[model samples]
Target: MKTYPVKGSVKLADGKPLASGVVVFAAPEMGMEFSSPLGDDGSFVLRSSYGDGAPEGTYKVRIERDPSKADSQARGGRKSAAPAPYPAKYGDESSSGLTAAVKPADNALDPFVLVK
Candidate 1:
């Protein structure tokens, strides 16, 4: 088993932080998926089932924000599921158009900017 440190941030096209989202790295060739929660700054670290890092391979990345969480936070904790700020295309691996190739070293991915 091999792994590498992977990390990056997500931003809107206008340069605002995505705030809260889940970062997914899907490696269908290896039959594995790694994920991590985005911080308030939209930064995330990829962690696989093996933990702490991801298997060395090519991966399609997707970042999805939980609308309910965003709504509640926006309304100061009153629970509500709002519409997603990003387009639907950004929520799926096949549509996001984001990819990364992880190596056996600290892989600092480039920042992803989601646009309509």
Candidate 2:
């Protein structure tokens, strides 16, 4: 299986970085999937479980906010008040409206912008 480095940034509707989250890429046809944690600036570099980059294919992209990280940053570390920053719709592959095509030679993906 070939691998290619895939990196990109995510931004909120207001044009600010997403801060922290997880970005998932699923290529069901190829039985390949990968995910990466978002940086403080909402940047991510996709890496597979085998420590290799993702294989070439089109992927369904999903972005989910990390609740544990959110809770700790929620002023008092309270879990209840730590609502997700992005809408629930964007957390699933079916509704995220995000996708990517990893070419055999290219290494980086374009930035993703999430809007409310």
Candidate 3:
């Protein structure tokens, strides 16, 4: 098996650390989709399930939080089941906050920033 490394940072619009989020990779032209949830530090390592990694190209990545987790809190024992404050959006190289294109040249892209 082979693996490729990719680094990232997840944060809210306020510039606060966003502990959890999903990074989706889709190559519509090739009918492929690959995604991974970010770590606490908002970093990720993208690889292929079948060792068929993402092809070198600009892809539209959608990011969002886990649906199972409740994002609300209350003073009492009760908890708010409010819907997620942040929705997902499709991102390209330019929109992904990368100085370089989201291709294989340097094999790395800039940290993606998500608005609150």
Which residue segments of model 2 deviate by more than 4 Å? none
Clashing pairs in 3: 13-116
Report the C-alpha lDDT of model 2 over 26-85, residue by residue, as the tens digit.
887877679999999889988876655688788899998787787777665456565566
Which digits, one per residue and each the tens of the lDDT, describe model 3 over residues 1-116? 33344445556666765566567776666686667777767776566675434556656666656544443344376665664444433244324432322444335556665664
lDDT of 1: 0.83
Ranking by TM-score: 2, 1, 3
Off by over 4 Å in 3: 1-4, 68-80, 85-101
Question: Could you give candidate 1's per-residue lDDT for residues 8-110 as a string of tens digits?
Answer: 9888888898888898998887778898888889888987668677987888988877665676676665675666668888889999999888888998888
User: By the lDDT metric, which is better: model 1 or model 3?
Assistant: 1
Instruction: Return the lDDT, model 2, position 3.
Output: 83
Question: Which candidate should be chosen as best, given TM-score against the real structure?
Answer: 2
| CA lDDT of every candidate | 0.83, 0.82, 0.56
* Best-matching candidate per lDDT: 1
lDDT, residue 78, candidate 2: 52
Candidate 1 RMSD to the real structure:
2.0
Segments in model 1 whose C-alpha atoms lie over 4 Å from true places: 74-78
RMSD to true structure for each model, in Å: 2.0, 1.6, 4.6
lDDT of 2: 0.82
TM-score of every model versus the real structure:
0.87, 0.88, 0.64
